[model samples]
Target: MRVLLTNDDGIQATGLHAMRRALLERVPGIELAVIAPDSNRSASARSITTRQPLAVDEVRFADGERGFATDGTPVDCVRFAVLGLVGEPPELIVSGINHGSNLGDDVTYSGTVAAAFEGALLGIPAIAVSQQAEHGRTDFRPRGRGWAYEDFAAGARFVAELVAAIDGLPLGERTVLNVNVPAGEVRGVRVCRLGRRIYRDELKLESVAPNGRKHYRIYGAEPGYHEEPGTDFEAVADSMIAVTPLGFDLNHERALAELGRVDLQAAFARSIERQELAHEG
Candidate 1:
């Protein structure tokens, strides 16, 4: 199977390297090509370049594997790879092995998740993987942390197997799998829905600069509210890997129907026509 790997963390990120190694070692007969951002662009969402031209560069690893890096967002990297870089589109698109968790509403702002979303938009099956870590903790040296590379590799292998076996699965138009691995040994995998998290404190504004500028920072507990059972957040908190299916199309159908009850469309059309006539005069 051919796979396209991309991430928001840039080509040099350790998590990206670890995931590439794991895929190569475990998934036999897999052809892999990577196209990623040249620098970290986390939380960039699904932005695409429209004005400036995107730049791509050839990159070589120590092991002689060739990949490409782009001066663009995660979604842009996937778009370029599918439309320009590869001779043929890949069978699967795997994003991240991200440095942190993408749970609940975080996915809405995550470049890691957006990469997979872009692939799904292009009609390819995709997966977004994230490793949950303790906030404010820096060293992810693997150690015997149980959430080490070995454990993550195991989970990755399981996900690969599932993808291979599940035929004709409804990959909703613009659908992608968002997988979050907990910060310790995984109990097992759980199919879940997005959960809610509430932060303890609001961001605080600090002192103003001599040039009359204000600075602000977010400070608070890792303390927060969590969702009830059967949610992605709950699954991770309980030491289980969470697999949440996500989609790109977001429309409030019920809300639209309610607005339509008052002949809103006719009113909108008349208003637009009146404005156009006024402008013409």
Candidate 2:
């Protein structure tokens, strides 16, 4: 099977490299194509480059394999492959073994998740995988100085096995399987729903320069999650892998019905009548 692997952590990232090695070694007869950002594009979401043409570079990865690096967002990389830029389109797209967990509302702002969303939109089954850091280790970079592929081996191998059985997985049209592996040993895998995040962002003024430009800090604070059962956050807290099926359809059927009960047409007609009366006056 031909699979396209991409990530928001750039080509040289440990997570990306781990995924490469796992897929090649575990998935038998799997042809892999790597296309990722030249630098970290985390939280870039589904944005695409429209102002200028994207530039692509051919480079050798840590595993001595050639891959493409682009000055584009994660979604752009997916577009390039679907547009026949990476030879024939791939049958599946696997995005990430991300440096950090993409849980709850975080998926909306995640470039890793966005790449999978793009693949699913183009009729290809996709998976977005991430690994949470160990307790007190906020930095999710490679272990020590050298590239520690084994740190991400478990999650990477799981994804490789997932790809082998993807045909049997219940992947709906325009849907993505979002996976998040906990730090340390993975106890088990749980299919759960997206959880809620409790943000504690504070706005602080760092400095005001001579040019009257003020430098402030609004983000970078640690976020908390609601202790809800059967959520992705809860699954990971129990040292389990969380797999949430995300669909492209954003329609809220209950809200639609509630809004339909409102007489919006009557309100428009009343506004028109008022305008006509004022014009006549």
Q: Choose the strongest candidate by TM-score.
A: 2
Name the TM-score of candidate 2.
0.93
- Runs of candidate 1 with Cα error greater than 4 angstroms are 135-151, 163-170, 218-223, 265-281
In the range 1-281, model 2's lDDT, one tens digit per residue, is 98999999998888998999999999988989999999999889999999999999998865588999999999999998888887999999999989888889889999999999999989999999988866333223334344367768889989999999999997889999999888887888999999998877899999999999999999767788888999999998888889999999989999999999999999999999999999999
lDDT of each: 0.79, 0.89
Query: Model 2's lDDT to the true fold?
Result: 0.89
* Tens digit per residue, CA lDDT, model 1, 157-231: 655665554345666767899998776567789999988766555678888899999898774445344658889
TM-scores for every candidate against the unseen true structure: 0.84, 0.93
Looking at model 2, the pairs that clash are none
